[model samples]
Target: MRRLLQKVLDKSQKAPTQDAPGSTASEITPQVMDGVGTGSEAVDNTQAVGTNPIKISSVQRLGFQNASNSCSHRDLGFTGKIAGKWYAVFGDTLWCAPGVKDPAQDLPGFHGMVRDSVSLLTNDPLTVVDLNLNNDSPVKHQLQFVPFNPAWGETNMYGFGGTSLCETDARSGTGAVYYLVNANDAGLIGAGVAKVVVKSGTPTVTQRYDGTKGHWWDAKTTARYGDVAAYRDERSEYIYLLGHPPSTITGWLAASYVYMARVRATDAFDLTKYQYWWGRQQGWKTKVLNVFTPETAVMWGTGQGQISWNAYYGCYVFVHLAIGGGTVHLRTAPAPAGPWSGDVQVYTAAPIDGGLVYAGVAHPYLDASGKTLVVSFTNNNHIEVIKVAFTK
Candidate 1:
């Protein structure tokens, strides 16, 4: 898969000066999709973002150019905006001390100091400023708000593997950002939540709901939510979450099923208050519902994604990667729990270092001009953003 995506990436980066024999200009020339100029021309890879076909105008890689010192931790660049500034949380960071050229070559896994990290996004979400770069020695980057206390035999390479940062509760200028925790490269054991307080301007994890049960944090269960995406609806005052079972669950990748659950924004920290959508017939229920069969699943093969309202499309848009495929996909729904539109291909991510593209998310707030959208994805090393416009 990595080789295949790399070839596509190589092809898209090339500029053919002349057409091949017997080929017309249309056949040999690169046609830009969505009419958005990328400075460098890209082959017309027709794809859709929701119902409208889109043109990718530009693609920019954010943060340190070298992998030895990335701005954010490895991958999972889902975003949140506080005080009009963008912030992103990353999982399992590896950084070399200053002057190190290659961490992989000099020290293995950056001397094995891997942990979840956070960063501040500036310059219109094109630059990453590592929040923990100034911390004391031994701390590579800004660490997780809540410290991980794993049981015996567990690795420390995981925390907030998949995270979603939503709005602060109106009651307080603070809120909780939920994520998948208790995981390693082997499997994700559970999901967790931490109270986040933005102090003087920086977001900090002050506390955690360690006692939550059921869907919140269960060491025995693998069907934890909040690992995909989370959003707080301003109009309804509900925190909607999209989730999928971890790979430890049988047939998870092959039969990927996404489930939707929601809690009142104010009650997001309480797991008991959550309710799951069981279609229009069964309605929302407290009891855990069965995974939607393939015929009934709203969206499937979604490993990671983000959901945000798109005023341009007049619906909620979901940008996610197809599990095991390097292709990014977009879907739309009238509401959070929906009768969703069919999947539409938007971008094909090129794999790096044997890692397929993951964590594709749309930053709706970054695009002021409603005509275009800003989206981001990563290969677990650095964040990449692209500007796209949808055709009417």
Candidate 2:
């Protein structure tokens, strides 16, 4: 990765005018909101009130129904969304309906998982739903037979290291990444196995940033089974990948240590080439341990959010639920793969079984000013969005 970064730096020195189009020059400035309330609040027509006092301006619900007039399964969890469309991955089950749409009061898709050899009707299959939230029609396009398992910890469908959606490169369209999981030889073992499928359109394309040979790479050898987080730098030419190890605990449990890796867009996708950037292990201090407890396990089907790069500190930040408790911790790293610093307590709550707080993705939602960072999550039931302002 260093080699790739150096190569990019060298090219910039040579062709300073070769700017990547659509790259933003503006720095991402985040402001933490004050007086925000915490805990479950009432909802009045999509508005949520809590001790934090932060307002939920909008609400969207998604799920599919069976002909018998029942929800597919209660365990379906959405991990990530791109282009305003949500991707639901299955857990504890092998079958699912992928794309589901929710418009108005109607819910169209069934998002849940089922184990192998189970009947579709009797067994809960992992499914995806396609929803048109704008219209009054809540109908879903179901993609059935998606392979995922909570016991195996394969709950994400985005690209490896959680960088981008499962698609080709938005810039050159020359390379693409697909999400896939493989079971260890032990047969559908722990956390299963997560892998990224890489395809290069250009066979002999030299690294534009660095003059390195290019070839396809897999996440198994490259990224592995950690939480994948990504951010587009100000230049946008650099897309950083934060690969943390798989959660140690399973089924609503947490682990002690979290490790990360950083990969660049121009860099080839190989584990040997990837750099170990940052990590967090249990600390000795009570305050630190309280903030970085390895005790809580993320909900059975939630996906870690994309890490937002903080150029000011040369670190990245994302929200994670502390182990054994439902508190959300704001963890930071000096780099995507890091010797990290700062395990600040952000929000706290007791575990709410099958509640909205524990079931959704944690994504950074910028406010109207683009100055305040709003972090949001959704469980199967409700959605919660919080405004975070940094004092520094």
| 226-299: candidate 2 lDDT, tens digit per residue | 33344434334444443322322223322223323334544533333333321122111111001111111111
lDDT of each: 0.57, 0.30
Model 2 TM-score relative to the real fold? 0.43
Q: Which ten residues in a row have the lowest lDDT in candidate 1?
A: 24-33
Q: Number of clashes in model 2?
A: 56
List of clashing residue pairs for candidate 1: 33-55, 34-55, 132-142
Root-mean-square deviation per candidate: 15.3, 16.5
Off by over 4 Å in 1: 1-73, 100-109, 132-140, 150-158, 183-186, 212-215, 219-222, 246-249, 252-255, 290-296
Instruction: List the candidates' TM-scores in order.
Output: 0.74, 0.43
